[model samples]
Target: MFLLSSLLCALAGHVSAFLVETSSLTDLYPPLWKECPGQFSDYRVENGVYTINPWLYPERMGMYKILVTFTAEYFERFAPNNEANILWGLPLQHGWQYETGRLADPTDETKCGRENGNHTCISVDSWWACMNYYLSVLPFFGAIEAGVLGISSDQVQLLPPPKDQMYFCYSVTTCRSTFPETMTKWSTFFQQAMEPSKSWDDLLKYLWDAHVASIEEGRTSFDDRSLYFPKPETDFGKSWATAMNYIAAIRFETTLQNVTKFQKALPPRLLKPDDPPYFIEDFTDSQNRFLFLLHGLNKMHNDSGHKFLSLFRNLMKSELLRKMANTVLEQIILDDNISPQELDIIFSGYI
Candidate 1:
C-alpha cells in the first residue's frame, strides 16, 4: 500500500510538470484551442506526437501565428521545409534574444555591462539600444543608396527619409560622434512617455506631430537651397524631389483615420528603396535594424497595440499587468489545481 501511494504521487508530479511545460504553447494559441474546443480536431496526433497539416488550413496567417507563438522546443519539432519558412519560423519561436542565448537578468548588476566606468549598467537589450543602433546605421545606407541612384549627398541630406532621423544631416556634419548623447535623450523621453498616468492618445498624437515636423524641416531645408530643382538627367532626382512634395502635402489633406488609405494610394515605386526586404541582407546591423522598425510598425497597426502599450506603461506599477503583458501565466500555470496564493507568488517577480 505504501509503494502504490508513492507511485501515484510520482505520476501526479510528472503529469503536473508536463502540463506546466506545455501550457506556454497553449496560452499563445487560445483562439484555436482554448476558445474553440472542438477545432483542435484539425491537428493530427500520431504516436503521441501532434503535427499541423498545412493543407488542412489554407490560410497562411494561422500557420504563421503558430510559428510566431511556438517556443524554441516546439519550433524544432517542425523540420523546416523551405528557406522562407525557416526565416519566418526562427524569429517566431525565438525573438532577438535568441542570438544572445539568454536575456540579461536586469536585477543582477553583474550580468550587465557598465558604461564608461559608471556603476549603473547600460543594458544593450533595451528598446533604446536597438533604436539608437538603427539611427546610427541609417546614414551609411542612405549614402550608399544615394550613390547607387546617382543622387548627391547634399540631396540625401536635404530630405528626412523613412528610418532616418530629423537631425541626421546635423549628426553626419558637425557632431558625427554624438550618437550616445542622442540615445540618452531618446531613452529619457521614452521613460517619461511610458509613465503609468501618461495618456496613450496623447503619446501617439505627439509621435504623429513629430513625424510631420520632420518632413516639414526637410522641405524647408530643400526650399532654402539656391538650386531647389532636381536635375533632369536622372530619374531618381526628379522622382525623389516630387515624392518629397507629395509627402508634405499628405499631412494637411489626410486625417489619422485616412492615414492607411493615403499610404495605399502612394506610388509603389517611390516606396521600394525604403522597404525592409531591400536592406535585409546588407549587413547584420542593418538587417536587425530594419527588422526592428518593420516589426514595430506592424505592432502599432495590430489590434493589440493599445493594450500592449498600456500594459507596458503599468509594468513597474502593477504585477498583474506585467504578467499579462509579458505572457508570464504560461510559466506560472504549473498544476491543474493552482491556489490563488501560488498564482500571486509566481507573478510577484521583480515588479
Candidate 2:
C-alpha cells in the first residue's frame, strides 16, 4: 500500500508538471492557425466599419487573437511569459470546433465549410457555428465595450450569415439591445480583467460566469438550425451544455494547460450517430469514456441538479487540486478495463 501511494503521488506530480510547463499556444495549434490578426489593422476597414466575418474561421479566430494580445499584459503577472493566459480557452475551443467539422455549412447549399469545399468557412447554417457565435461574438463584444479592442463600440461590425438573420444580432448596438443581460455578463468579465490587483482565480470566476451566460443564450438561440442535424448530435449538444454547468461551477481552470487537456478529452467531431458505451469504430477508448462520463454527469444533474456541484466546486478550489482531479479523470477514461459498474462507483453521489 505504501509503494502504491508513492507511485500515485509520482503520477500526480507528472500530470501537474505536464500541465504547468507548456510552450506558447500560438506555437501549437489545430490547423489553419498560421495567421490570425493580432492587430485590428489586419482586418479590412472601409468607411470606419471594421467588418469581421465570423463565418470564416480565421476571421473569427482573429477576434480571439486580438483578445489574447491585448490581455497578455494582464496575465503576465500570473505566470511566466503569459502562456497560462485564461483567455486561451476561447481560441482553443474555436480551434476544436473547426477541426471537428462543426464549422461546416449544414444546409448543403453551397458547400461553404466541408472538407472538399471551402474548408475554412464557418457556415452560418451550421448549428455548431451558430452556437459558437454566442461564445465568440459575446466575448469580443465585451472586449470592445471594455475598451480592450482599441475601437469604439460602433466601429466594429459583425457580418452575419445570409440567412438566419433574425437569429443573430450583428453590431454592438444590436447585440446589446437584443441580449442585454448576456452582453453585460461578458462585459463585466472584461471590466474585471482591466482592474488592478486581480488574481487568476478572480479572473477565472469572471470568465466562467460570462461563459455560462453565453452557453445559456446559445442553448436557446438555434432552435431551427439545430434541426438540420440528426437527433444524436442535437442530444450531444444538450449533454455537453448540461456538463458545462458543472465545469463552470467548478471554475475549472481555463489556463492553457487545462484547456489543452480538456480539449483532448472531447470527441474529434460532433457526437457520432452511435452513443457511447456502445462502441463507435472511430472513437478511441478515451473518447468513449469521455462521452460516458459526460452522459453520466448529465443524468445525475437532471436527477439532482446544482446541489452537490457547489460542494464539488469548493472541493476543487485550488489549482493543484483541480489539476490532480483532471489527471484522475483522464486516467479513468484511459482505463478500458474499467466497467460501467466501476464508473458508477466513481460517480456515485457526485450529483
Candidate 3:
C-alpha cells in the first residue's frame, strides 16, 4: 500500500509539472494589451486609426526582450544552434536592441561609428541597430523569397552571409515607407482571394499561391526599394491558425459572459431597438454609434458587477459584433486560416 501511494504521488507531481510547462508556453503570447501594457494603456480608437505612444517603445522593447528570451530558450532546448532558428532569432534579438537604442538616445552620433571603413558602433544599442537594420529585414525578405521559389515550409532555408562581408545598416527610412504599402497589397490580395466561394482548405491554398505570386512579381522583398509582406507558410500558418482559434474560442466564451453582464446593466428599451428613437437618436450615424457603444461597453467591462441589461440595450444592434471582431483581430494576425466557417462557428448564436 505504501509503494502504491508513493507511485501515485510521483504521478501527481509529473502532472503538475506538465501543467506548469504548458501554462508557461501559453503565457509566451498573451493578449495584445497584456503583452505590452505601456503601448496599450492610453490606446484610443479614433476614426479607425491607431496612434500608439512612441515613448512607450521602451516598454514594448522590454516585452519583446522577454519574448525573445523565451524564444531563444525554446530553440536552445529543442534545436540548439539550428541555422534557420539562428537566422531568425538573431535578428529579433538585435532588432529589440536596435529599437532600444533608438528609444534610449536617438541623437547621439558617437553611438555609431566606422570600423574597417564600414559603419560599426561603440554602444551595444547602436551596433545592434546597425546589424538589425540589415539582418532583421532578412527573415521577412527570406519568407517572400521562399514563396517565390515555391519552397515548402520544411524546405525554407537561408544562406549564411559571406565571411568578411560588412553588415551595415540599410535605409530605415525607405523600409518604413515601403513596408506599409506591401502590407496593404497583401491585405487586398487576401480580400480578393476570399471573394470567391471557396472552402476553408481552398482558401488556405489560394492564400499560399497568392503569397508566392506576390514575391515572384517583385511585389515583396527585403530591399527597402521593394514591397514586403509578412506571410507565414503552411506549417507556421497551421500553428498560427490553431493558436488564433484557441484564443478566439477562449475569448469568445469569456466575452459572451461579459456581454451578458453588460446587457443586464443596460436599460430595457435599448435592448433591440423596438422604439425608433433608440435607433434614430443613438445610432443614426454608424461610426458615432459604435464609438458611443464602445464607451459604454468599456465602462461595463471595468465595472465590478453585472447591472441591468436594459441600460444599454441598444448594444444588441452591432456593438457586440464590432467588439468581438475587434477583440479577436487585435489579438491575432489576420491570416488565411480565419475563414468564414471558422468565424461562423465562433459567433453563431452569440447574438
Candidate 4:
C-alpha cells in the first residue's frame, strides 16, 4: 500500500517537474559545448580506428555525450527527451568542473586550462580533473563493454595525458584488467540497466553503487594533488566529496531535469576566500543559502547515525514526502513560516 502511494506520487512529481519547462544549457559555454559525438567518425579517426585523448576537454566530453546518446533508450520509461537518463550527471558534472576552474593547472606550471593557453585542456595536475576522469572514462568504457556504444572496444583507443600514463587505460581490455573490481561493478551496472525487468529504483541503485565504487577506487590515487590549491579550494573539495556520500546513499536523481535543478545549488564560479557556506561574501544569496543547507545536511548526516540514511532513502521513493521536504525548504527560502497543515496534507498517507 505504501509502495503504491509512493509510486503514484512519484509519477505526479515527475510530470510536474517536466511541466516546469526548465531550460537546457546547450551553448552556454563556448568550445566546451561544441557537439555531441553521434558516431565514431565525429571523433579523431585514422584508418577506420578512433583515437581519443580524454585529457582534452572536448574529447573527454565527447565520450560522455556518446554515452548519453546510447543509454537514452534504457531510461525512456522514466521521462521524455531522455531527460531522465542517469548518465546526464556525468557530463553535467564535467561541465561544472570546467566552469568552476576545477580543471585548471593547480600549480600554475603550465596554462593547461587557461584562456591564454589550452583553455580546454583537462589538467593532470588538478586533483578534481583526475578524480573526474575515473567517473567519465570508466563509464564510457563500460558502455562499450555492455554493447551500448555500438563500437567494439578494439576499435577505440583512450590516451592518458603525457605524464599520468599509469593512471588510465587505453582500451576496454586494459581497463577491465587494470581495475578489475571497479570495472566489474560498472559493467554490471550497464548490463543490468539494459534488462527489461529493472525498475527506476533498480537503475538508480546500480548507478549509485557503480558511482561510489568509482570514487572509492580513484580518490586515493591523487592524495598529493591537494597540495596544489589554496586552503579554500581544498576545503571545498573535502566538503564536496563528503557531501557526495550523503547524495550517493539517497541515489540522487541524475536526470537532465533533476541535474539542472541540482546544479543550481552549486556555486556558479570558483569558490573565493572568505566565501563561507553561511555568508554571501563572494557567492550570491541563493548559492550561500544552498551551501548552508549542505552544511546542515552534513551535520545531520553525522549526528543521526543510520537515521539520516533511512529517512533519505525513504524520501527517494515518495513524491509526497519529497513535496513535504520541498515545501519546508520553500518556506524557509521565502523566509516565511512552514505550515504543518500543508505538510500534513502532502503527507496524507503512509503514516
The estimated TM-scores of all candidates read: 0.21, 0.83, 0.24, 0.78
Error of 4 at 230 (Å): 1.8
Q: Where is the poorest 10-residue window by lDDT in model 1?
A: 81-90
Preferred candidate (lDDT higher): 1 or 4 = 4
Q: Which candidate is the best by lDDT?
A: 2
lDDT of 3 at 47: 50
Quantify all predictions' global Cα lDDT against the true fold: 0.31, 0.78, 0.32, 0.74
Candidate 2 residue-wise lDDT, 233-271, digit = tens: 776667888778777755677776767876776778765
Better of 1 and 2 by lDDT: 2
Pairs with backbone N, CA or C atoms under 3 Å apart (clashes), candidate 2: none
Q: Which regions of candidate 3 are displaced past 4 Å?
A: 1-7, 19-35, 38-44, 54-56, 59-103, 106-351
What is the lDDT, from 0 to 100, of the residue 29 in candidate 2? 55
Summarize candidate 1's per-residue lDDT along 1-351 as a digit string, tens digits.
999999999999998987775564343331222221122233454553333321111111233333222212222323321111111311221122222222222223344423233222223332222222232222222222223222233322222323324434432332234443333333332333335454433333333333333333344433322122122112222233333332222212122122322232222221223444323333233223323333333334244534643444445245444335324322222222544344335434521
**lDDT at residue 220 of model 4 (Cα atoms):** 73
On TM-score, the leading prediction is: 2
The full ranking of all candidates by TM-score, starting with the best, is 2, 4, 3, 1
Residues 253-336, candidate 3: write the lDDT tens digits.
221123232222122211221433113343323322322333333344335243423332234235455356546543322333
lDDT at 260, model 2: 82
lDDT for 53 in candidate 4 is 81
